[model samples]
Target: MNTDIAATLPGATKTHRDESFPVASRLIAPAHRAVVLAFYRYVRAADDIADAPGLAPEEKLRRLHAFEAALDAADPAVPLARALAEADRRHGCGAAQARLMLDAFRQDAVKPRYAGFAELIDYCTRSADPAGRFLLALHREDEAAQGPADALCTALQILNHLQDLVKDRERIGRVYVPEPWMALAGGEEAFFAPGNGPARRRVLDAVLDRVDTLLDTAEALPRSLRSRRLAAESVATIATGRLLARRLRREDPVTGRVDLAKADFARAFARAAPALAHLGFTSDAAVCRRIVAGSGSSFRLGMASLKGERRRAIHAVYAFCRLIDDVADAAAPAPERRAAIEDWRREIDRLAGAPLTPVGRELQAATRAFGLDPAEFHLLLDGMAADAAERVRIADAAGLDLYCRQVAGAVGALSIRIFGATQAHAFALSLGRTLQLVNILRDVDEDAAIERVYVPLDRLLEAGIPDGPATCMVQDPRFAAVCRALADEAEAGFAEADRLLAGLDRRALKPAILMMEGYRIVLGHMMRRGFERRGPRPRPNRRDRLRLVTLALRGQP
Candidate 1:
């Protein structure tokens, strides 16, 4: 409460009561509550000093160093630090974890902009992760809980950064939105301009997608905790994070303050209540199901009849493909995309060891259960790296085939094993390529929007179009000729898949047949519309979904 000391001023006196989400509250037991508060106060004081206006960066650094020294020496002059030191002695919440936050605050005193999402995430690991780790340590929760807790904490911090975007920029001259992201909106100036709402919203939504992925990983935190009270608290925190993320997505933070209402907390607590009794926790299967269902992919319809582990295995495969595909097509610089791909590569490599990501953990189990090959996943990543370029163009039919085999065909190879159809490799390869070709036809306009033309360069040239920008190639009259020829090849591929399907076990390959039928229907739609026509690709309607489900039930599709 002292105002004389630079780091002890009441100017930054916000408490747990003032936070957007709960800090240390009644949810924490009385035995642990005081120590949590002490930790919060120490960190909050350092954050305030770093954000203090009219103070030189050197002065902020000096004050922060003094706070760290106070903790080291148990100096009472810095009352919050002294309190935290005493609390640490009692609770064993490591000072090392608390110092990570001090380091982040010190970075904030000097660093005003983030280079990219990865850099921003690194910042979050220091600024936010330690808080969750502190609680985990205090409660003596399993070390495995730390990964999900870090995920939840980092998500909360990013959500806070997004909510405080305008305020942070206007008040402290700091901008947490990655600079590369701003570049995508035409530059930092245009990105922040009031008139740039639509562009800013697109960028913000991409950031929110990243947040959603983090929340998905954090979904395990509640179930990972052993202490009933902490489990309940974590469930509430995760619910609050998810609600706030959705709110941020719908409401533009740039236009005004977008945040949660008091009712939101009540709703989160209501959602968390079931967890206190150690019930209603979401499992890895549930997370995978959500991902697959949320995608609106036709494959979900095919997998509908499966139950138990088989269904979970299918969902796991589809979710892995969907997530990596997201990384490939993200609205980021190519280098950043490639870097993200590398991170995925590392995650895939960890499957045999201790994997940190939620999807990876689920995948490891699925692979082990199904005897799935891990090498196929690396193949998928290789294909994604090809697409994560500044511009994408297939050189020829062979090139196209290789790309499809790597991406879609590899998925088929994995899925068939999960389907228990071990001998369906030929069927899987044929249908995968056929479906990918249909995808290329449907996504010509959409892919061109991102400077990607999956139509082979040789085909384009033979159709009398030049090898130039993807957008221009799509507009050329000759483009339709190339598409028609590819459509014929796709039809043949489908026929080959059907022939191969007849030789395989129908019971085992039912899911593949259903998916092939769905894609065939889409192909028929495109053929009827003609390749010359240009517009949004037709999506399966409710009627289409019902028909597919019917076929699946009949064991015919």
Candidate 2:
């Protein structure tokens, strides 16, 4: 199908926001509105040429290339291209996305028929992927999310084709229905015939199912975004996609009209209203996803193994933890830092009421959805407050455990709830301690530079070390023994965690299991290097990931 949405229904261009399709809506930041509209105008103009009733194939291609020339520099005659180029320069929106749309339009000018679904999907890569990638670049979102966004855009594109199939065939001899699909539906001529209503709807039902799954997968994209505007806008898009898919399934295309009222789109906007705010709005889920993907590669990998809502909830939890860490670690006076921690604790107290930030709203949503306690969140803030207090010093094993309980164990308990593991508090605490121990040992040098040490002072003194940084002390024979002891402690934590994991339903705990295995792998590498500076740190390489996959599959530690 031609990429122009306006081409589907005359006068639709004036009401793009009300249609079940993507456009820069009122949700976009005011500063970004002009650029987004420029991009749309550029693509819309190209789509117009490609779908024009009078334009020859060569003429359409020439006009598309004119847009490319505008991208390089200003074009007085091509106003749309000039505006798009200005948007690209200011927002870093790349010209490659525009070029991609051009390819789709050029193809549409000549190739009107697709032999198979694969061919049609390939067409969508150029046709649909560019629009989404354009939005990503405009908002400075991560490239990792573009694939999911593309899948969504392609599904929308397919839905549009299915809606316009008859109109396309009658108007321009374009046939989006693949030959195989027509053959299976009782041959091409019969399938398109008015008499073959049941057979056509049956075949279209299979295609509609595929669109449904794609739209479902696309739900992850909104949370994966960094920009609040983009995230909220994406939520609106997803709402529309879901509603349209239902319409396609319930209503017959051959006989019944699939006209969605403005009110239907209004309901979709209502469903995703969590993202809008007084000035700007963004999805908390999207914000958390960006934080996880940006902060830790290993944990993100493990979490990515989760499906749909489970993955989103965990990301929100991690994002909260990361936010606490940031507040504690911010460069400021100790008193101010402590005050910041207190503020977060108070937020947890009144979390049941209106939220003041995207993160708060998202955290509240996760708590309600996953049965998480506000006390758990408050405990996490207290842990941060511990580090914020005047140059934190751990004097003994009990002190270290107290610190770990507040920071890691509390976090583990929350994660347990999210992952559906009950009565695993002890196991969760052990996992947190073991992971914290690994991090402390791995960052010994870096931590010492900041005058912060997680190792117990008593243990260091017992090793016969005087007043000196642990960075240099870790090299001594007596301190190496302490390192060995610390490694042993971490191993025990892993063992306990593994034992608890053995009792839980294996499928839901896969992400947590992967995380444990990642740390265990690091611990093993640390032990081999005698827990020294040269030891491998806690990260999952391809080989480690393969082994983790095997462990998850076999349900073993």
Candidate 3:
């Protein structure tokens, strides 16, 4: 190799043995390992040039473009590129994946800060997702598995960013943690400060939770693969990712590297052994079920009573809602939020045709099977749009009602259809409003922390409190009176639902009734605790869960 070519491969000297990911591990067949290594070497070479310290950005771009052109021309002087081309000739592992990664390295040469996680994901689409795609292509895995594989790769990439947080900032003058996310920790400086542990922990944990959601999407990847070796490898890799995420949660990377021990590898591979015994696939419905169960949702307890397709349908619905809610609640700009919502809107339009995302595909099946109204989904989107604003404020009682109707009542309307009790739409709508009010009342401090106030502006005025910042509004003594008034309204709404439930088909609406009773218990706690007492918001205890379970089994609401 020429000296210039050798210079370009400075970072490529470190082999897969030095990396965290199991790149071309022994699990891969001997026939395929050479090609995988060839691909890794090519990517590693480009990454080296992009990350080389003291190198000018212009020089990095020129070298990367030259290397990319070299691969296209099958230039022999660039040994890694020639090797990959030869592998592609034998095994047909296309060069497109490597080119996407080169694009990412090109970006890395100039870009240092990400505006938001969405932008970071776009970066990952090039930097990380292609690696998974390349592996799947090599193993001849179905394209249907690509979503989960992309998720796994992206999750791992984000976790790497988290672990390298301090080092990336100090060494490369780069910060992959989004600027908006850092704002959650008080600002970039405070976010990295040694003394801001609690605030920093909250932000980091939120990022880890997002990673956990990605891992949940990835849980299906191993099972979906046709090759046993590849399946086992994926299983072990996912286990390692989960272990690292957990470790990152307990230990801060700001102080130093937070990584897995050698024992973790044994544990991960041991966890993968049972997977070899049964490589049975998981369906989209099962994936949605796992997502809902893992979410620790309050609705899970109520929805558990329904068996078979009804249960699957509700899980699909809830998962869709949860995903959209996450989009709305993300710490992003208003336009970005709206753009994400629009993307979902387009997805909704495609439901009757063929939606692209896992959640969308599952939702499409549920909507078609159960005759779920798409209009209700749009209403839910509208509600999310309201919340996705720069700040959330309710002008009056009617505004609150409309907001509830869009967010929760729309959910209720959809739930009744899936519950096989369309006749109980009125009851569903009433209960939805009541449940949302209780949620608003209980989450006052939490909502305030996020710059949201569901307390009506008129109610605040009536309490002699001026409309202002959410945190300020929640702190006033008069705010408790405002909450009490809403709680009374919620109590009345619950009574209306109870009356409506009495006249309906008790068997079909058992799930809805159980949820109603559960929320009523929460409302009871709030009433007894009093809004004036500022402690943890009221929630159902373990005894309440057992009682709900009993009621569910007995078919008694």
Candidate 4:
């Protein structure tokens, strides 16, 4: 509706250019595309301004304030202002969610370090949870839906921050690891010391413990979403979050980058599907109570808000994902860790033969009910092993593709199974691949700084760029060429995602569309900037994001 705002913002072009909405293709129902696009554009735009480079500290503060003021005024001239207004007009989008985005940007500008886990949760409340809440509102879900949505969102935000700790600290000079834990490890100065040493390990262990606590909390939110469709989403998110958290806990924060393998994602999805489906039919209070009791502390606040069979199933799925992920990410040496993962994989395998533990029993029941395949579970373990092996440097587009398949695409395969998307598996896998590529592109700078390259080696060589993550982005002609090539590949992946969306169920379409569009927007930014030069990463401006949202609502697909 307001292209003027998109045109006016200095970063709007870059934001759109940098983002890669891999899932926002023709596969989506033309009806829902605009709304999905609009939401993503709004989020992207806000993020861009918050992360923009070359602005003085004062100027950054001023810009953030101006953005916040726009939210308050409902001015169409402001970037996200129109989207917020539209969400209100059409979907009853709350001012609180918009305000939360602004607050997160404010935090980005000011808060560089976290004091403790509580403070970290406060950040997630502002930054990550609001997006989930906004999406729930878009779906016209009631307070009951909103509560669980918030929990899942908050959990995801916490897990993401934990996973990116090393990269966040090294590239951004900001640390999300709690201050108290850092103190216990040997103080801030010691924690950041060059070289992987005992102090770093100690700090990481403390951080892992904190992560486990947060994950326990996150597992509690899915029970509130009574709708089978929404519960599936929540379960997938929880399973994914817990898996990542477990990796963060088990990995050597000094050397490895924590990421969910595609196979693992599929397994989580398969394991969570039946419970999610069951939620559609039952509203048993006892079931909800059992789930709440098992979820540990993360669900403590959320427990009182929900009651049903769906809640219990969600809790069981979350707990299982968290435990399995931890097993994969355990701090043991690679061989031992792989062995453990294999053992877990065997246990999952034997579920078809016989049940072992409560979690396993639950998973077996759910898998049977959902008609999930055992092979998907094995792929998850394989992906976890790949991650544990620290084998994810971006060497070329081919390598990147393989990595994406291992880390994210596999999840798509599993998700379709859980969603009963038998016919749409190919499309789902394509969308998943595109999303994974977008992630790699978005985190290029940060990933490089942490010595984990998801970029392909062949691409780098073709571009005549150095293979090392830190040096690849330097300003060289070949470096620029390589970046362009990679970006093009990402674009191609996005195209596939678009095709995939057209085949998915309508109820399951919007969220995937929004996520895809968000990533595509990021990839667009990367493409525009020649990807090689990275003083700061590019993202969408608020106005452009709003425009995208409007387009999504219009069903442009």
Measured by lDDT, the strongest candidate is 1
Q: What is the lDDT of residue 402 in candidate 4?
A: 69
lDDT digits (tens) for residues 281-381 of candidate 2: 33456657766775765677567776677778888788778766865664334565576677677767757995544456677887888888888888788
lDDT of 1 at 307: 69
Pairs in clash, predicted candidate 3: none
Candidate 2 lands at a TM-score of 0.50
Writing each residue's lDDT as its tens digit, candidate 4 over 360-379 gives 55567657665656676666
Query: Which is the better candidate, 3 or 4, if ranked by TM-score?
Result: 3
Flag regions of model 4 displaced more than 4 Å: 1-33, 71-80, 144-148, 194-198, 271-276, 279-557
Q: Against the unseen true structure, what C-alpha lDDT does each candidate score? A: 0.86, 0.73, 0.85, 0.58
- What are the per-residue Cα lDDT tens digits for candidate 1 across 1-557? 22335434536658888898888767788889888888998899889989987788998888888778888877777777788998888877757788999999999999999998888999999999999999999999999898899989999999999999988998889999999888988988998898998888878877887888889989888889898888888888888898999998899898889888999999988877888789989887788888898898878766776767888888888888898788788777788879888988998999999877778888899889999999999999999999999899889989999999999999999988988888888888888999999999889998998899999898788878988878888999888988898889999999998788877888778888788888888888888889888677777678877887787788544
Which pairs clash in model 2?
Answer: 223-286
- Give every collision pair in model 1: none
* TM-score of each predicted structure versus truth: 0.96, 0.50, 0.91, 0.45
Runs in model 3 deviating more than 4 A are: 1-3, 11-13, 69-78, 140-145, 271-278, 331-336, 541-546
What is the lDDT, from 0 to 100, of the residue 438 in candidate 2? 86
Q: Which ten residues in a row have the lowest lDDT in candidate 3?
A: 1-10
In TM-score terms, candidate 4 sits at: 0.45
- Give candidate 3's error at residue 512 in angstroms: 1.5
Model 1 C-alpha lDDT versus the unseen true structure: 0.86
